[model samples]
Target: MAQLAVFDLDGTLVDTPRAIIETFSAAFGSLGVEVPDAPEIRATIGLPLQRAFGDLLGVAPDDELATRGVRQYQIHYKELILPRAQELLFPGVAEGLAGLQDRGVTLAVATSKFHASADALLSAAGLRDRFALVVGADQVTHPKPHPESGQLVLDTLGIPAEHAVMVGDTTHDLKMANAAGLRSIAVTYGIHSAAELATAEPTWTVDTFDEVVARLDKALTTQDQGSAV
Candidate 1:
């Protein structure tokens, strides 16, 4: 049986915070609202756009203004953000992904970004076709930290939670992975620091994608050897 490797897109595989922030700022500028500072924008990295926008704009969510904000953000994101593929994939990311794929592991992406935007980024980063499944915020009713997205990926990949592992860069990812009963591995190169990620109590915390690959390789090897016993 193949193991499932799920990933978060924005901060994990691709460093898209700058593009996201600039696009959101442009969106707010269009709406005549004050643009949030970089730190404020980065803090909401893993949330759905409505929640992120509401938090950053200091407006109540589920309101008419938040609705408009979501709409405007989408427009600005497509126009301003989608074109900028400035964020490079973290070191060893492509190599690690390829290595996992070569080992017959099923890989997927579960992110809070909209499906279209996620696709665009992955494509731009040369990672779009590598994934077996892609679950986006728009694809699920409940986004991450809720486990719905992870569950959706597992269902799509026809894998059980025990055979799956989630690799991400935030407590949100760790929470979702834990909620879904999958082992979560946190990467330190993203928005959250190691200390913040520690709060999520991830199965492992890695500083680089290479370390992630190494840990995953060890886990897979152990599982294989155990099954043979």
Candidate 2:
């Protein structure tokens, strides 16, 4: 059986912080509200859209304003993401994914992005077929830092938590991996700084996609020998 690797989309596989921050700013602008600071908006990248917008707008997630913000952000982002999808992929991602698959690693994506949006970008990137499954916020009842999405991916792929690793750039991703009983690989080149990611205490930390692939190669080889994560 192949080991499973679960990845977060934004900040992990895709360098989307700039786009996301812009989308958030534009959404608030459309509502005639001051945009939240860029860093503050970036900090919400791993959250569900409604929650992210609500946090930035200082409203309840279920409030009409927050709901409207989600709609607006989606409109702007969907329009902006397609043409830029392949460019947004962090360098070496496609190669790293291929390497992992060659070594019998099954891949899956778990992201805070809505299902259709995630599909669009992955398809545009020509990387959709690499993943055995993709679980977006809309595809699960609960999102990151909660483990529901991670568990759903595991369940759907029939992979046990112990045989999987979750790679992500945010605390939400690491925390979800931890809660889901999977090894966590924290990547620092994304939106969150290494210092911030350290607080989550990932099983392995990588600074680039090359490092990620090398680290995984070592880890999986060792795991195949019945030791290490």
Candidate 3:
């Protein structure tokens, strides 16, 4: 059986606070509202735009203001993110992904970003071809912390939960992995701190892109040896 590694985008493979934070602030500013603090905005990184916007606006996700905020955010994101997509990738990410793919791990993306937006960014980053599958929040009934996106990715790719691991940088990602029955690896070099990630009880916590590769490599070796036995 093949091993699968599911990843999140913004705070995981991509160190993307600039586009995200600025777009969020732009959204609030356009609506004549005070923007949330950067840290508060950062805390919502892994959630769907509606949820994040809702929280920041102090309204329900479907409320008119939140909807407007999301629309405004989308506009800002395209302007801020698309032109410099590759530059947003975290250090060692390209190499780490190359190494993982070479080792025969099936890769996929499960992110809160909408499908069209996610694909556009990854393609612009020259990374769209790396994954066999990419499941965005727009493709699922619920986003991270709900397991819908992760389960959709796993089911679509015919990879069982046990044969896959979810790698991300937020509590939402780890909690989603837990719900989906996939072991979780929380990368601390992104949005959340190590201590914050611990609250989600990830199977393992790593601090760098290199550590993620090492852990997956070790997991595959263990799985291989167990099969041999």
- Predictions ranked by TM-score, top down? 2, 3, 1
**Residue 174 in candidate 3 has what lDDT?**
94
How far out, in Å, is residue 162 in model 3?
1.3
lDDT of 3 by residue, 1-229 (tens): 8899999998898878767898898888999989889989987888899988988888999999999998998898899888888988998889889888998999999999998889999998989899999888888887889988889988899989988988999999999999999888899888889899999999888888888888888766466322100
* Tens-digit lDDT track of model 2 for 12-102: 9988889888878888888899888888998888899999988888889999999999999988887776789899999999999988988
Clashes of each: 0, 0, 0
Q: Give the TM-score of candidate 2.
A: 0.94
lDDT of 2 at 201: 81
Better of 1 and 3 by lDDT: 3
lDDT of 2 at 12: 92
lDDT of 1 by residue, 66-132 (tens): 7788888888777765565534677788888999899888889999988887888888778888898
All candidates: TM-score: 0.91, 0.94, 0.94
Scored against the true structure, residue 13 in model 2 reaches a CA lDDT of 92
